[model samples]
Target: MPQFELANWLPQVAWLILTFGVMYLVVRAALPKVEAVKLSRAKVISDDLGHADTAKTNAQSVEAAFQAALVAARTTATKVTGDTKTTAAADAAARLKEIDAALAAKADAAQATLAKSQAKSLKSLEAVATDVTGDMVERLTGRRPAADAAASAVAQASA
Candidate 1:
């Protein structure tokens, strides 16, 4: 009942106005500090974004340089490997040619030696065959065959 009484209304209105006025002045006084903090924060964020972009660009350039170097190194290595293989192949062919020539010379020498030995053995075998035929004829007829005839007979049989 007292809250709603007409006679107390003016005092309550006065106190309410006084309280709200003080709160309004305090909020008004802090508005510049809040605006300053917001501006500083925005500047810091903008600076960070610019730095990040610069770093990204630098990283991309460095990565491109590294890739170029890698490609150049691979090309150099491939060329060197090809040159080495060619040299090795040439050396191998030269060595094989030398070995083949040496083997051919040795085979020719061995064939000459074999031919000489075969000719000497054939001469000795002919002499032995002539003697055997003469002895066999003398044993069967009690008369020795002539040396020239025995040799001629052996030669004819062999021919």
Candidate 2:
């Protein structure tokens, strides 16, 4: 081939400049809008994540409040049961004391009645024994005791 000339090289250089200018315009002007759209999408994603965190915190607070209320209810139930037990024990004690007092009174009255019956039986038995002894003495000795002597002997024997 002959040596390259400026006339042929001019068209190639002009084509290169035109292609580069178009590429530069596309990159500088259109790429910024794409980048701005991407930045806006990233901001929306960050805001969503913040909202999710707030919702999780609210759920945890509700759970804690429910647990506290359950604990308080259990404590109140236990206290009521304890109070009922104490009242039942007090009632039982009062009944036992009343029964003991009644039994003691009955036993004292029975003892008083027994003592009075014993004294009356002893007096009757002494009179019967005196009459039998006097009859036997008169049959054996063929003599009767005087009234005053018999009275004195009966008194001494009874004592």
Candidate 3:
């Protein structure tokens, strides 16, 4: 009933108009700043995303270059390893050949010394056999065997 009273409506209408006008002016003054802040935030986010994309692309390119360098280094290392192995093998073969030749010479000298020692031992053995045979014959038959005959007897027994 109070809302519908026609006599109180003029003051209510004036108050409503004043409040609406103040609210409109306040909103109108602040709205452009709010919109500007929102647009600026969006632009900053877009710029950051663009920069991230560019950084990612640069990182990819750097990775690609690093991979290429690594491949090249590996190839070079393989080649160097192969070359070193080949050189070492060749050197080892040469040294082995030299050592074999030296060992063969030393073996030949050792064989020559062994042959001379054997010959000396054989001559001394023959002399000792002749003396022992002469003494044995003298003890058994009261006569000593001749040196040449004792030597021949020893040679026959040995054969």
Candidate 4:
């Protein structure tokens, strides 16, 4: 009932106006600071994002450089390995050739010794055979053969 009276309407209207004005002024005063804080936060976030992008780019570049270095190292290692293998093969070939030469020389010396021994044994066998033949002939015929004749006959028979 008091709210519906005409006498209370003006005071209510005046209070309403006062309250709305204070609220408007307070909101207006705080709006710029809020906007400034929002903008500062946005700028900070944008700057952080830019720094992250720069870091990402730097990481990519560093990774690429590392890959390049790795490739170069692998290439150098392959070349060195190939060179070492070639050197080892060459050294082995040279050593093998020297060993083969020595073996051949040893084989030739053995062959010469074998030939000399064979010649000496043949001469000894020839002398023994001649003596045996002369003794056999003397025993069978009761006459001894001459040494030169027996030697000549043995030589002719062998030839």
Name the candidate that leads on lDDT. 4
Q: After superposition, how far is residue 37 of candidate 4 from its true place, in Å?
A: 1.8
Report the Cα lDDT for residue 147, model 1: 90
Error of 3 at 109 (Å): 0.8
- Candidate 4 regions off by >4 Å? 1-25, 139-143, 152-159
Candidate 3 C-alpha lDDT tens digits along 109-140: 99999999988998888888888888999999
- Tell how far residue 11 is off in model 3, in angstroms: 21
User: lDDT order of candidates, best first?
Assistant: 4, 3, 1, 2
RMSD, every candidate, angstroms:
4.4, 6.4, 4.1, 3.5
TM-score of each: 0.64, 0.55, 0.67, 0.71
Candidate 4 per-residue C-alpha lDDT over 1-159 given as tens digits, one digit per residue, 9 for 90 to 100: 898899999988999999999999999999999999999999999999999999999999999999999999999999999999999999999999999999999999999999999999989988998998799999999889999998888888887
lDDT of 2 at 119: 76
lDDT of 1 by residue, 1-159 (tens): 898899899998999899989999999999999999999999999999999999999999999999999999999999999999999999999999999999989998988888898878777878888888889999998789999999999989998
Give the Cα lDDT of each candidate.
0.93, 0.81, 0.94, 0.96
| Local lDDT at 97 for model 1 | 95
| Overall local distance difference test of candidate 2 | 0.81
Instruction: Give the winner by lDDT: 3 or 4.
Output: 4
Better of 1 and 2 by TM-score: 1
Give the TM-score (vs. native) of candidate 2. Answer: 0.55
Q: How accurate is candidate 4 locally (lDDT)?
A: 0.96
Q: Count of backbone clashes for each model?
A: 0, 0, 0, 0
